[model samples]
Target: MKGNWLLLIGAYFSAVFYSTAFCVVTLHVDPESHYLEGGKEGTLEIWLEGVQNSEEVFEFTINVSTNNEDVFEITDKVLVVGSIKSKVPYTTHKAGNALISFEQVSGHHDNADNGTIVSDVGDVYAHIYVIRSQPLNVFNIIVGWIYFTAWSMSFYPQLYENITRRSVVGLNFDFLSFNMLGYIVYSIFNVGLYWIPKVQDEYRDEHPGQLIPVKLNDVFFSLHGGLLTAITIGTCFIYERGNQSVSWICRVSISIGLTYILTLAIISSTDKFPNCTWWHFVSWISYIKLIVTVVKYCPQAYMNYSRQSTTGWSIGNVLLDLTGGICSLLQAFLIAYNSDDWPSLIANPVKFGLGILTIIFDAVFMVQHYILYADAHYSKSGRFLSGGGSKKGYKKIHDSEKGSSENSNFFRT
Candidate 1:
């Protein structure tokens, strides 16, 4: 308890420091236009530094311009800053800075050619704008990383448990099959959309204004999902408890049929059948993935219900998955709230809905394991029942043992 308390305290202080560092406001004057001339129009550029750390919509108010009303006129009274990480430095081939541009209107000056002309350039005064702060990025990053970590490690617990027990009796093979299919589709969609040049071109053409930069996190997330799914499938093969109702042939056929149908649908809709744009096909694949994710846990839940126990399933995996799903949902909410982009939430319903459903299913699993079937277990003779009655009586009863033994051989090598 004392160690846990110390860890909590340390985490709290670390979070506080990280948040402070992330939200620190810094501004730099652009060297090119620090000095400005009046009457002659020139852009007065002020760069907002550390904008990458901000995940909220904010306005940098030019309060100084209001004070210099008599001397100078500014075009933009307020500048709206977006939550997107600025690629200005990379694109413009300059140091990193979120550029804020303001047009300086002509200032009042005497005629230089006639009697007397006062140069406004020398006398012109430029003042710094006060930034209205929003520090949602700190929270977003923290929650995002937590979700990533949880998801990345989620499969290990179940895999380890299966290996140690040398059984996959309580696990639903259908659940694994569906999950692997979903991740395969998801990985293809993610990689094709972001990395393929042809897809990038088509996507840019379709949505010219939207800038969705594929970050390192996205790549890692996709890779992690794919890797874990493969590992879990391998573990399932190794720890076969012979309880699988679905045959390998049927599973393979279903996978191929689904893939073909999705592909055909995408191709038929486009002008170019086989040579259609990557973006169009990826959209179809994404929807398939969404459907798969929605129903992914159904098989496991049903198996648990029928067996009245979660004997072979790892509670650690469920807990980690639950944490990851909740964190993912929270991260999305934070992004939408901070950016004031409610439309995005509606636009990507699949991502948001998947998180919500995963969390709900995780909760149900917890209830089944801890409350509903608390004392449920499988007997040595392969009968599943509550562990409250006479153990010898249940063991001696072997009425169903012959049937179970026959079924268990179905998947045996």
Candidate 2:
């Protein structure tokens, strides 16, 4: 009898270990999201994977619920799940956003729903977006790509100016300093969230049922930005930028931003700060980027104001930035309007606020280039302007600080 009892316990322990190590369940809601106009229809393919075939298994119930019933008309029912998979058809009624949740409430065979029986069955969600119209939805998607392209190309104009002119005089040093640091922090945040397994796990745990916000393009953009920004900074070293050096103000600002960013990273690694995780660290880094964006343009704008000319600055970069800002705002509004989720406009204050700020700065640069300083002539020295805007106490301002000393500079735009 003692040997029989020991043999039974050993079998149970092996089964437990096998189930834990080998059997991993994942609930897949195909497509993850659907976009439709009001009164449209869509089908969702639901499959619960990793459940081994067992003769004793009977059935399971996948309870379906929605955050907003107005958007999708879904009928929740007990799906015997013969093969652990089924199709769920849904219809849209009005313009709104909703998440349809699928959770395994119970299992007839195991009599256990908490995953110890077969595998862990967690909640899966599919998004239903019943927009006001199809055109707006298409517009929103198109605008998203447009802004992405615009922002991505914006860097090239400035890079080309520095490379072709071999001069980075009009390009503010403070702007370069802040921009390089911002991209460095941004690249770290993107890489950590997207590539690091530990950070990915923490992010999934913190925001379950939601797709990881960092995507391949985001990772590419951040890294691309860092690389380009670094190259531009290098140009500042090799180019014919006369007496143009990063100011004290820029150094102090960059030092503080980098210090804070590093502190967060260390806190995440050492776990010195309670509940501060890699997710939290990246989040703080992204926020710091927003702060950086707010100030990064200021230096360039101030420099333009002081110099009374945007001779060294590339207007192509400004125009591209303006296009990106416009498209970004348009896309945000289009999405909000189509889904009737107006409040989502402000949901991500950082992203929205950054867009607004970028537009404002672009407008300033445009005015300086196209209107305010359009008539200003670049002298041989650019070290001195014959007659222009404020000359109060602005002595550091130099004409040699301007772009190409030659009037025939092709990068005037």
lDDT of 1 by residue, 214-252 (tens): 666776777787788778777666554654655475476
* Tens digits of per-residue lDDT for model 2, 134-163: 987777878888888888888888888777
The lDDT for every candidate, in the order shown, is 0.58, 0.73
Q: Report model 2's TM-score to 2 decimal places.
A: 0.84
Where's the lowest-lDDT run of ten residues in candidate 1? 88-97
The segments of candidate 2 whose C-alpha lies over 4 angstroms from its true place after superposition are 1-23, 54-69, 80-84, 110-120, 272-274, 379-413
lDDT of 2: 0.73
User: What TM-scores do the predictions have?
Assistant: 0.61, 0.84
Candidate 2 collision pairs: 382-399, 382-400, 383-399, 383-400, 384-399
Model 2 RMSD in Å is 5.9
Native-to-model Cα distance after best TM-score fit, residue 405 in candidate 2, in Å: 13
